[model samples]
Target: MASTLTRLGAGILSKFGRSVASPTRLQSRPYYLYSPEPFHPIPDKQPLCMTADEAVTVVTSGMRIFVHGCAATPIPLLDALARYGKEAKLHNVELIHIHTEGPGILAQPEYDGIFRCNNLFIGANCREAVNAGRADFTPIFLSEIPNLFRRKIWQLDIALIQVSPPDNHGFCTLGPSVDCTRAAIQNAKYIIALVNPNMPRTFGDGVIHMSHCDVVVTGTDPLPVISQHCCSEEEEQIGRLISENLVQDGATLQMGIGSIPDAVLSKLYGHRDLGVHSEMFSDGIIDLVNKGAITNAKKTIQTGKIVSSFAFGSKKLYNFMNNNPSVVFNDVAFVNNTAVICQNPKVTALNSCIEIDLTGQVISDSIGTKMYSGVGGQVDFIRGAALGLDGLGKPILAMQSQTHKGSSKIVPFLKQGGGVVTTRAHVHYLVTEYGIAYMFGKNLRQRAYELIKIAHPKHRECLEKAAFDRLKVMPCP
Candidate 1:
């Protein structure tokens, strides 16, 4: 088992080396067939109810297991799995998922041979393991992750998920997360579910019958709580600029997590009939919903409903979505589809970046050689909003002018290994606290000059010098 893991890890490291060397040549490879799956689930069979420790006994060495992510991350099952694997002397049991939370013991160096993580989208919990070369990172768009399962690109042996308890007629829902779970369950040979009463009974593509479950473990874990973001002064300024200049009263919105997004949402209370169609949303939207700003009435698609793939936020946010027909959690394959997102009017996609080069190349996934987060839905919404139906769509990239360490985020060139998640060709608007830089249809010099104007005042002169050196043209009025 150890030898098999070494062979697989070497293959991934070699591929990762090439990806770092020539990013264009890097191709994504999900978990390969470690070994043959011996067990096949029977049809129309009732699930065997068991404790967490007993339910996890079905997992074995050399099998790829998909762990549920986000607010619905199964704590009890994972803790039990950790204990069981250590006690049973397990090895080479690979775990795959997107940005799950909790004190991720399984991905640490201590669990090297016992448990390994294959991350589709890296998160804070797994960031250290990924950077230390303990876990593997796959850079794929959220829109396409479903195909890995639905098309059998990645063979799954088991899917570990958490869900709301069974309703009358024995129906259970995937709750807050429905992004890729549907596809995972359809392809997995067996399913193990944790029935948590705290999981919100959401509406959309997350429905499953109890008969589909191979093993069921009951839990009463509370959803992980994220406190509401208090926007900084710079973030507030960016929010105001976007709200006043870019977002229309009836615009359909797409925003990612963090303080800037929350700030933008804070400023939108006056906007009317605004709709949300994002890959994921946080607690920011709850206030807008309360203030009658997010009526979802004017959206061209999914009228009168807020369409999202998954949600992560405070308990207040979850409570608002509980059994609420207005908030729909669908699969990302459909929700983040460019065609689907473009159908709406004034599609305003608000995204952030780690840094952006003078030529408008935006890097969000990594800093230099380290992978911080994954390219989840930045391109999905950026391209979607760029092709918006009414031509009023705005794809705005907002970030602070300078980092906390006083380094310029708008640079002459991207750091050597930064992943260009949004290309210069796709960039429309770049915002800083100073002002907005409209990059669409701009010449190289013009783009640099505009970006420099909004850069931190202290760095503008150096940026000008650097721009002249790189572009070989004086950015003059």
Candidate 2:
């Protein structure tokens, strides 16, 4: 202990008024100390158990609360929080987080008078609120989320989380979601955890000792289930084209979750020595992993391991990751770091967006003045894929050329106030159902012409008129 403290850099120790040095594992309270074997829950309950109502009292009015994200969300606890908010006018309590699954009860119109979500990442659960202007959005990188908590910028008043039942050693697991929960749990003033039995005992920086938890609520509710959306014919064709373009035996890959990503993964059945180090993964990657396609043999960073921060899919995906060693679920800060992603050669990032302007301004989060999704790790992987000092690399952004209502997705200009999630400088390749368009180093007029060629045939004439009107050129620049 003395030597460890002496070796401290003094900056962390002085700022936090505590030791910055890491203590010996045996000396420090081991998060998993009571475990005679892994996967075994504690035999007896401790003294900190409380009813749902009692737990809700901790959250006062006008407070800033952080909820656990992804599969680790505590649904019962959030329901209780909503109940309390209804009973006691808990107005102005700001809700902050990335996309959390399940029905966003707090974001509904009934609770609009009390809870105002400042969503950092808009998910389907909170889409209506954002589109209706009842909630707000923040466009930022996922890697920088922890800094907000550590620097006391957000100043979280309470953190609501869910975890696996404690092991024999009195340490609980953070389960499927660890992205920003570790930082939130460490920095919040009061921490309330719902100790659930069904939460997967995931490995990583997700363990918490019994002493660190201020309140524990025993619950038996099942974790939220994620449904897989199927790929359309257009997506399948685009996926085939995208897959055909890839060179056999390429090392690294990064892809966001969706039908197109699944389609692309399905197309890579015959490819050899592929790897995955993505922000998230779906059931598509599972089949590839089973077939030995994703051996992680060619990856430069975290070699020989499938890496991701979180995952959402059917029961098959959850069951596969339950006790799997091949998948290493780390935090978003590490998984989505551009520098780390760039280290892996032939990094291909497959991302989706709502619209792309003629000049290559990608907007994935909104529908023309309506906010849809938050900026969540698209630019991180895109820029990382573009860091091809090797000269043979290309960063690809994939999206359908048209929306479901037959509206054009490739626009002459972004809708006013639409966020430019990806800048023109970072864009390289754009793929749609029609074909692929290379926009790197192209002038404004050439870029417009190439993108229009990929736009849906029904919208092409109108798009051409808009492009020529904007650029003031006869045909196109």
Candidate 3:
């Protein structure tokens, strides 16, 4: 097996070298394929059921632990661990993750002395802790996080996971959360699971046999539900306009969580042969898939597969994916690579932004100097769409024209100290409720004009003044 992997790696390296030497063939050779599946799961002897307290007891002082990501968070176990933080006097137990759902008591100030958060991706629950200096972040590509574990770079001591009840064959699915859990389970010295019948049994490389869990916490809790926030009339209009621009039979689609994405999906019922290759999805795409709009029929990569790293939605979405071959839950490392993403022809990566400057710098992860979301798979799929073959397509940055407070999102400059999640050069299409601005090769002045045209009428004059002041362009007085 090692010899085979080595040879495969060498072949990939050689191909990469050839691509660097010749750019034309690079486009032709770009396609996605999976490595052969690993053998059926190897089960350990005698899997024991235990309470949440018993499950967390394996974690000791100064140990590094990985928590399950997205909706499949082991909430009962994590809350129990927080309670254990007091009883066991567990000090310096570090919790690392991209994002998790639930109370996240471990991130509270009371547990600061006992637990430290090393966030790979910051979500709202841990945002305060991260900003308060109780936590720190590791800025790495989503595609490389699993490698950190596989290479023993992070050295996981324990993993807290939630899984479905064992099937007839004794294999348990990772449920709705599979992004980093596979790596955590493989790398951790000990694995503890919360087994809930309520958790859906998902398909793909997201399973482990009952015997593999060192200790299992049998708990009954409804899987957490995340419904789509309603899309405003303006958002719906934006979505409709963007959908109108889509090719009649585009083959691949990549969308993230939020109203804009939900809005976009809401308008795609008429389109055909749509495919999904995204980091995560919510309730919006269910109708499309059910209506046979998303057939995944024409995709060159993962053909006929709904490929994603994680999922967040109501129980309905969960039920649909349970044991469903239509969905393949893989690691972020594999799902978010730009090279793999563009293989599906007409890949339209519709991502959101916190705000965008006139010059097209996207500040999606931060507000001014403070961190909000992390540097996710945005750039990965964006570049993938831009470089896709046959002049096929480009990524879309979608957002509303104005903030809830009526402030414009399109500005002459990003807020001071804000991080640029997407560079100016990479932005291809910027869409708002008003219209789309194609700024792929536009100069700074031209970008400013295009962006301002879509800015809310209330803020247009202000932005124009700012741009004029900064660029020394004569204002139309």
Candidate 4:
């Protein structure tokens, strides 16, 4: 296995070299027997539109398939695949993707043997299947997902995608989610697209000529929209602390979706020349962009563009991204690359965690033995921001002091079976409603004291006692 992986790595490096030399290059050798011609917009040739059933007929048993994920999941294509699996009794079909939103019919218990999901990031839709041993999850960084397909580590037979209709030039956009779908489309043996009029015609590397798609099915279903909740007073307070204490003017930002990130963006109205280069962003950024707060003027990379791999938000957010030249959607590998991210000046990476120990270990993916979320791009952005040019970047982990049930999120040690997504060496700034805890360059005892200081007042005493009992360090009264 080691030797095989080594060979694959070498082959990828060779291809990478060739690709850098020639941007319009194609693979010299095909993974499958059928190889489509180079993509070019055919001005006069009309597309052969078909029904969902007709498109699904091309799928055969034992073929590896790629499903577009997130809000852009191809529902029509997925439903067709499920129906086909049931009607044809297909077996050994592998479905690969990241966190997808929706029912995920292929992952249903009835299709256990017909379709097996290999997920990079597990979502609520497939969590039950994974836990029940009907599906499998591969713990990996979002930054490296595109590499798996681009490098041919996993040769895909079919690519199922949801895209906007072709324009005058016969080019269609991959819409809101582009993370690894671009790579999948480029590498897959056959491309099956669910062309939807509702999918936003987003700009950037997401645009592809219609000639690349082998089968196209038109649908009118509304694209999924994820709404953001109003941040609580405590969350707002934490956001203020982070914005005032850590975020600087002209800083580049990397943040994820949620209430905390929303609160932080709300507080950044006064900041100047702010830039966004996150793995994923939500509706909070739209207001900032409209107010000229996020000018993207001072970023070292993509200086005047909002760079992101994927986006999730309301219908308004989707409409805002349509044909927007300022927003540049790229693949996850480039958007989340640590080296590429640190090129920007004063990169501030805002992330959240499930829980953290006094020693500064972060548990962001799993809760005890249960997989809550995947280790998406926390470490990628954290390390990138920490190593920012000339110490201007900052990695801030923000969360509430207590859970909804009033339990302290700060603990003496991580719960058993909870994996550490970020280690002590990587943790720098920890923020809560109370205050900020600067953990960089601090010893274990000092870290414990600092963390306990920012913990909820009701739990501070108990946390200090636990730290003393575990680390044999006296608490500072």
Per-candidate Cα lDDT values, in order, are 0.85, 0.76, 0.79, 0.84
Residue 364 lDDT in model 3?
A: 84
TM-score of 2: 0.87
Compose the digit string of candidate 4's lDDT tens values, residues 191-236. 7788888899887778877766655777888888885587899999
Q: How big is the positional error of residue 386 in model 2, measured in Å on the Cα after superposition?
A: 0.7
Which digits, one per residue and each the tens of the lDDT, describe model 1 over residues 1-477? 223223222122233232222323212212223321212322444565667877677667777889989998887899988988888788998898999989888987878899999999997889999999889999999999989987889988888999887765466788899888878876777778898888999988887766667567778879987865578899999999999999999999999889999889989999999999999898889989999999999998889999999999888888989999999999889999999999998999999999998889999999999999999999999999999888999998999999999999999989999999999999999999999999999988999999999999999999999999998998753
- lDDT (Cα, tens digit) per residue for candidate 3, span 1-477: 223223222122233332322213212111112321221444224344556765565666788889997889889999888987888788998998988888778999999989988888898889999899988777767777888887878887777888887765667888887887787777676677788888888877688765556566778888888854777898898898888885457658888888888888888899999988888888888899999899999888788989998998898888888878889988778888877887778989898998998778998888898989888888988988888874686689988888889989998778998989899999999999888898987888888888888888899889998988877883331
Residue 151 of candidate 4: its Cα lDDT? 81
- Per-model TM-score, in order, reads 0.91, 0.87, 0.89, 0.90
* lDDT comparing candidate 4 with the true structure: 0.84
- Candidate 4 off by > 4 Å: 1-47, 475-477
Model 2 pairs in collision: 33-169, 34-168, 34-169, 35-169
Candidate that scores best on lDDT: 1
Candidate 3 or 1, higher TM-score: 1
| lDDT winner, 1 or 4 | 1
Is 2 or 4 the stronger prediction by TM-score? 4
How close is each model in CA RMSD to the real structure?
Answer: 10.0, 8.5, 11.3, 9.0
Q: What tens digits encode model 2's per-residue C-alpha lDDT throughout 334-442? A: 8888878888868888888889998789998887788888788888888878885454445788988888898888988888978888998888889999999888888
